[model samples]
Target: MAIPQLKDKQVLITGAASGIGRAAALAFARQGAHIIASDLRLEPLQSLQQEVQALGVNCLLQAVDVSDEAAMAAFAAWVHEQVGAPDVLFNNAGIAYLGKFLDSGLEQWQRVLNVNLMGVVHGCYHFIPLMLAAGGPRQVVNVSSTASYAPSPSMASYAASKFAVAGFCDVLRMELAGTRIGVTDVCPGVINTAITASGAAPSMQGEQLQRLQAYYRKEGCLPEVVANDVVQAVITGKTLVLTGPYSRLLYHLKRLSRRLLFKITLGTAAKVGYL
Candidate 1:
């Protein structure tokens, strides 16, 4: 069923050039929402704008890097000026880093956290005021990862950033409890996207990276599955959504037995040479 609230609504999404963000932009556009899409790349955003406009909805495209606070602030101002406050703000821009803590340097950790954690922060810091001013029913969706709860030794930076995002969402939700704005924490498991290939994994060889990418392509779920969950979450005011294959199972297992979850994850990581 189409959501009545989404029709003709203003929805702002970062990282909309590809992967989950791209899927989400299309999903929202299909519901007749006006899309405000951004990414660090321009070409893909243009292509996405064409697709979104073809869906018979308006799309405003921009090349904005979420990690850059000043740029994000300008973008937020532009959004407010262009279409007033957005009914939904999807802070979905993120990157991945895969390596043991000792193997990765400070630069790698900083880069990961800057994009994955601070990007979400920048979005909320700049856009929340606009939503507050508009003051009806609004949604803030933050894209976290299953790694937030189900930690892995090989993905130290990625896990840390996601854990921070999850924590931030929890606090933000509590703070906004009395308001009409709803916060959603979206945790996705493996999904077939270019992130696996584009992520930084310094220790892995070329052949190993290729194998890992192939594994994700074969075993991961589609990005649209997560996008559908995002739409449902907004409609129902869901606080937490675990999407994609093994996402729910992993969350449950982590809650059931952290030690067991670690044992299983560590064993699997070893098998895949991620250790």
Candidate 2:
């Protein structure tokens, strides 16, 4: 199929203040897409708005906590009043937790799950109906992670939330079959982002946290790489997108041999002190 044109389109992106969300905002702006960038931080959101406007495209910044259902509903209502339905909705707001399940408390799980999973839920619950009602070519891209399929030992909360996101996207995709809207699950592996620096759980501290941050700085792919793939997925209507080599490899390994993949993952988890 011919790639869908993005010029003059409206794109809604969550967590647009930084990381993959920031990269995607700039990328879509370059394509002449009007950006609706939402995030929890007002200052960063303002900075992003300026950058997007510098690209000569319209950008509207909404400061919102994505985990709050009522707040998302309000945001969605505001969008309808100001911009009508978005042509593309990118559910990219998420948080990370970096400890074993046993070490973590209910509050940690609730916090991570609220942001990583319920945030996506709120975005979809509010925006998807509008997309369908508008009756045009629309796209929903839910940002998951390689951990959705490639399970690690200590990051149970993070993995579980991503897994839920992937599964939700799959079911939504099937439900939207034969419609103008397409649902895509975007799985990004290690990407160089401030998420590890700022969003890591308290349980990861001192040497372990430093080591984890160092590894990502040395080896993680750029967020722009994932942003580009996300754009492609929307244009080409991809159902599942794996952004990095490791993500693809691990996904295939899981498909080929679940048992072997589990054993290998366990060994790596041990070496990384994730056990």
Candidate 3:
């Protein structure tokens, strides 16, 4: 299929300071989109602004936390007041930590839900209406994960959050059925980023990084790959968007062999000492 075009459009990306968000910001900028890059990390957001601006596209940097609904509303309003309503909103801000459900503290669980689940909720509540008002060429890109397919022992809380996001995005897509707005869940397996380095926030990749390094790392992917996929999905309005081959395989297995895959997953986890 011919790739859909996204030139000269306004795009907003949360979690744009690092990892997939940064890559998405840069990628969209390369496509001639006006970029609004946001993250809790102001310094990195500023750096990304500089870098993308050097690419000769407009970039607005905002240090907004997606978990906060009030702040998200304010951020959207600011975008309207400044960069204009985004043709695309990458609701990509989230965090993860490793802990079984029982072992996870209430604080950790709430934090995870706030960012991973409620963050998406807040973004949708705030942005989708604007996209509807704008009437066309609008997209909402949510960063989910393959873990959303089922329960992950070590990533119980994190998986729960993603599951919520995936389901929520699905409903959002349905509700926007006749509208020009669309939703795409960006589910990626693994990508090489600082998700493992020191001081990494308790987000989706934080806890899994150590285990991947020990046993699961397999040729990993680049964030740019997901960024490219996001652009394609926005243009094509694909319901499900995954980054790598392994991710697609896992997705297929989830649909084709739920019981068998669950058993094998447990068996392999036990073998690898992850269970």
| Candidate that would win on lDDT | 1
lDDT of 3: 0.78
lDDT of each: 0.88, 0.87, 0.78
TM per prediction: 0.96, 0.96, 0.90
Per-residue CA lDDT of model 1 for 89-165, tens digit only, reads: 99999987776678667788888899999999999999998998898689999999998888666688899999999
When 1 and 3 are scored with lDDT, the better candidate is 1
- Per residue, candidate 3 scores C-alpha lDDT tens digits across 137-244 of 678888898778844566776888999999998898888877778788889876666553422223324435466445534556778888888888887878788785
Tally clashes: model 3: 5
lDDT order of candidates, top first: 1, 2, 3
lDDT score of residue 252 within candidate 3: 82
Where does candidate 1 clash, by residue pair?
none
The parts of candidate 1 lying over 4 Å away from their true place are 1-4
Residues 1-275 of candidate 2 have per-residue lDDT tens digits of 11389998899999999899999999899888999999997788887898899999999989999999999999999999999999999999988888767777778788888999999999999999998998878998899999999968768888899999999998988888878888889999888898876555556677877877776787789999999998888889888889964799899999899999999988876665465
